[model samples]
Target: MTSARIALVTGANQGLGRGLVEGLAARLGPDDLVLLTGRNAERVAGAVAHVAADPATRSRVAGRVLDVTDADAVARLAAELHDQYGGVDFVVSNASAMLTPDRSQSAQADDFIDVANGGALAVLRSFAPVLRAGGRLLVVASSLGTLGHLDPRLQPLFDGASLDEVEKAVESWRTALHTGTAEELGWPRWINVPSKVAQVAAVRAVAAERRDTDLPADRLIACVCPGLIDTALSRPWFTDFSGAQTPAQAATAVLDLLLTERVDPATYGELVRFGRVLDWHDGTPPQLPDGLLVN
Candidate 1:
């Protein structure tokens, strides 16, 4: 009875989120449950039905409405899961702001707020305490979020502190972005790069706090980048798909990390892409191997 492994995924209605839920459904034991969540209940239900329609996965999938930006809503969900499932064994923080082709340029600054959530980091603040003892949480973050993306001069802002400090830094960047000084201030040309740095920063801070807690056992948390995938979320941004993988392909790799069930001390507070734990380089870009040849 206690052998049932419980897992949950945020933003499971589309794109990579749906892929992850499908991957979990296939990997987990017959009795295990994978809760597929989305901000919209109707969309979530539809996604679950589509993914779980297969007789093999139908029994393994469930749906719940979750808005990661809403703190109280997340708290309620956490409490409910605690009582109902005895706590969740796996959590994938995959909710991120989706940019549309018709989005107004004037509204871009406002979108920064969503970007600032750092997807996984912001949601984890509410969900971390509720994770089952010895459970794992994976943040669908990016390597672009590593400290190396920040200019060395501004990297100090993220040095050894709470997610609050990181949040504050993001607000500063947002203000600069609104004021048209972000470029002068050394924020990257790509919005995702700086925002991702915030995600990794939050993950690092929270992971350190978890290490000091009196929790039952290892509660592992880390940021994971699923690589460039051919999806609506990314297709508009990239001109090339030659190097990209499918959502299912990325999900398979991420699931391997989630189901590993134990943490590598080195990967404890890192941003992982595929299976590689990125090297932060202390705010310096990683140096390429000398004289490397490529065909």
Candidate 2:
């Protein structure tokens, strides 16, 4: 018999998170289990039932309550998975916080610190070590976070830097924002750009740390931009949904990347879209069509 193929998705009660659960449900083997997690138990169970209602995924999906912001909870989940299954085969950090409706400075700052940085950072700290040999760690991020967005001086902060350094830079951004010096400090007015860049940098930093270990080649890990999807996260920012892909459509693309048997070394720790590793270093597409969700 084959080993149980275990996979987990964070913040999967709705939107792209739910779509990813359905996509994984359709692809996982009979013996495999895909855990869809959310902060609320009821919501997560509902999502699991809804996805499992489909005959193709009827027996393959389950739900768990996990609030990624709580480092203790994340650590416990990691320990539980390691003890129960020896480790996970695939994990996607998809539960990210977005700017709130009011879009107040404090709210945006909360999103950045709590969900974007704290949440993603916690997941990586806990799960990266518990990933099964040759497993995959896919961080859900936006193309807007690429290094190219930062001024040339700030770009070096992420390139080959340690996790501490990346985190320090993130803290510096927060400090600047609170002091109203963010713009003068070269931080973009659209804070998500810096938030995402730091988030992805943390991923790369973790991967680099793992490489120094004597452990046999570690898991396949990278940040993936799920493209412009018509979801709660993007709908508010964009007036047009015509150009956006359905959550399921975008989810399929991400699933394809996760389930691939082999990926080029260059793609590791890079920002990818639909299996294509993006040129995140210096930026690209000299010019982009206005109001389009190309990423």
TM-score per prediction, in order, is: 0.87, 0.90
lDDT of each: 0.76, 0.80
User: Pick by TM-score: which candidate is best?
Assistant: 2
Per-residue CA lDDT of model 1 for 167-237, tens digit only, reads: 88888987777777776888764565667777888888888788755134766788898989998878756
lDDT of 2 by residue, 12-58 (tens): 99988999889888887888889999899999989988998887673
Q: List runs of model 1 lying over 4 Å from the truth.
A: 1-3, 100-106, 115-119, 212-216, 282-295
Best by lDDT: 2
Off by over 4 Å in 2: 100-102, 211-218, 284-295
